[model samples]
Structures are given as C-alpha cells and as structure tokens.
Target: MRDLEAGLVDAATGHAIVATDADGVVVVFSRGAEILLGYPCDEVLGSHVARLFDEAELGSVLAAGDLDTDAPARREWTLRGRDGVPVPAEVVVTRRPGVGGVPAGHLFVATDLTERRQAEQLQDELIGKLGHDLRSPLTSVLGYAQLLDDDTLTDEQRGYVNAIERNGRRLLHLINELQTGTGRSRSAWRGRRIRRR
Candidate 1:
C-alpha cells in the first residue's frame, strides 16, 4: 500500500504534492513539488511547510480556519520558491485521516498557473493587434464610401453607398468593442439603423 501511494505521487509530474503532519511538518514532498519549488526533498523534509509560503498568505489561511474542515479547500496561492521566486498556483488541501478516523495530516495538491496566465495574455495581445490591423483598412473604406455620397450619383448608386456606410459603421463598432473587451451583444447592432446624408 505504501509502495502504491509512493508510485502515484511520483507519477504526478504535472501537479505538485506536499504532505504534512497534523502539526504542519513536511513529511512527503513529491518530485513535482521539487521541480516546481526548486527544493530538494532532502532539504524540505522535516521542515515546517509554512516556510514555503509568504507570511501574510499563510497567516490568512490559518486565520480563515481552512484546515479545520474535512472537505477539501481550494484557493489561489503564490508560493515562495527556493530561489525566492513566486509561483502562482491553484492549491487544493485535504485532511488525511489516520487510525480511528482522526486527522493525521494534510495533503496539498497544487497546479501551476504561470503558463496559463501567459497564454491568456498573449491571446489578448494578438486580438488587440488583429483589431487594430483590421480597423485601418476599414476606416479607409468607410471614408471612400462617404465621399461617394455626392449629388452626381444616380438614386441606385446612392443607395449602394448608403448600404456600404451602414455596414461599415456596424463593422467598425464591432471592432471597437472587441478591442475594448466589452463583449457587447451582436443583436444590439442589428437593430441600429444608420441615417444617410
């Protein structure tokens, strides 16, 4: 049974697992924890788990009585690494039961959020760039359409110009919303009617 538990913890390379005794003394530090925290098991074992957290963060958790419950508690935490770097993570902590159903220790499983945050930021940048690139040419098209609305044109030609300007304004409005991350409804645009000059 011990061997199976060890194997499971060792195999989880994507999630850091740290087990502590009821008093918060480090008992098990998985390989994933070592890689994420830059701490060797030799140095971390028998040490207080509080050392891995910022003082204020640890204090908040303790004050919140998160450890007093049997149900797993999850929260976002910024753990201090061996090199003093901060690692943002989503952490789930559960109480480990011992003999006679008494709480023997706690198990912490943490998933690193650094890569996810970076990817989201990059996506926002790309979207902003695409919106800017599209708006420039669209502005030119709208300007030419406006200039074409002169009295020299036939009635049908003027109607075509009106359609172009209306659709162009709608498209521009959508692009502006996208750039601002407002995510306004598309149905709102459908009901709007742009007046012709």
Candidate 2:
C-alpha cells in the first residue's frame, strides 16, 4: 500500500503533494511539490508543513479547527514559494488513518490556480471592451433617431420614426444592463444627446 501511494504521488505532475506526520512534520514531498514550491525534497522533508503555506493563511486555518478530521477539507490558499512569492492554489487536506481509526498523518494536495485566474481576467477585459464598442455605435443610432422626430412628417413617417426611437431605446437599455449588471429604465436616458466627435 505504501509503495502504491508512492508510485501514484511520483506519477502526479500537475499537483503538489506533501505528506506530513500527525504532528505536522513533513515526511514526503513529491516532485510536483518541488516544481511548484521551488524547494527540493531534501530541504523540506524534515521541516514543518506550515513552512509551505502563507503564514497568515495558515494561522487562520489553524484557528478555525483541527485538520486531522476524517472528512477531507478543501479550500483556496496562498502558498509560499522558496523564492517568497505567493502562489494561489486550491488545497485539499485528507487525514491518513492509523490503528484504531486514529489519524497517522495528513496528505496535502494543491493545484495551482494562476492560469485559471489570468484567463478569467482576460475574459472580463474583453467583455468590457465589447460593451464599450457596442455602446458608441448604439449612442449614435439613438441620437439620430431622436433627431428624426421633427414636425415636418406625415402620420406614416411619424409612426416609423416613433418605432425606430422606441426600439433603439430598448436596445440601448439592454446594452446598459449588460455592461452595468443592473436593470435601468429607459427614462434615465431621456433628453440625452450625443456630441459629434
């Protein structure tokens, strides 16, 4: 069983795995942990597992409750790299059961969240740019529609102009909602004019 666990840990390349004794002393540091944390196994093996975690975060977790529970605990944490940079990670800590169901040790597995966070930030920026691009043209359309509501037109012409104005205002309101993440009334835009640039 120990050999099987070691084999699995060695094969894992994408997640950092650190196994510690019940007293929190590091015992097994996987290759993935070395790459993720910038620390070789020899330097980390005899140290306390807390050295790999951000101090404040570790303090908070310790204050919250014991980590040797039967159920695995998962949370987002900031790990301290050997170079002293903070590495965002999703961590899962599972207790290793011993004789009579007591905890012998704990296994800490962490997955890096840096790339996922960067991708999300890029997505938000693109959405904001798209909203700005859409709004500029929409403002012009609404302004032109408002200008066409003059008194020199037949009933049919007036009806067509009114339809254009109404639909344009609705579309603009929808765009504003998308950008701001809140519903706003079209009356908020009443009497607003676009300046030529």
User: Which candidate wins on lDDT?
Assistant: 1
How far residue 48's Cα lies from its native spot in candidate 2, in Å, is 0.9
| Model 1 quality (TM-score) | 0.78
The segments of candidate 1 whose C-alpha lies over 4 angstroms from its true place after superposition are: 150-159, 184-197
What tens-digit string does per-residue lDDT give for candidate 2 at 1-197?
Answer: 99998989978979999999889999999989999999998999989998999999999888988584678999999999999999999999999887898788899999999898788677667657877988888789878878888889888998887877777777667667656657644335445664322
Model 1 C-alpha lDDT per residue in residues 1-197, reported as the tens digit of each score: 99999999989989999999989999999999999999999999999999888789989999989988999999999999999999999999999998999899999999999998798788678768988898999999999999999999999999999989988888888778867767765335445665644
**After superposition, which runs of candidate 2 have C-alpha atoms over 4 Å from their true positions?**
66-68, 150-197
Against the true structure, what is each candidate's TM-score?
0.78, 0.78
Give the TM-score comparing model 2 with the true structure, all chains together: 0.78
User: What's the lDDT for all of these models?
Assistant: 0.89, 0.85
Cα deviation in Å at residue 179, candidate 1?
2.8
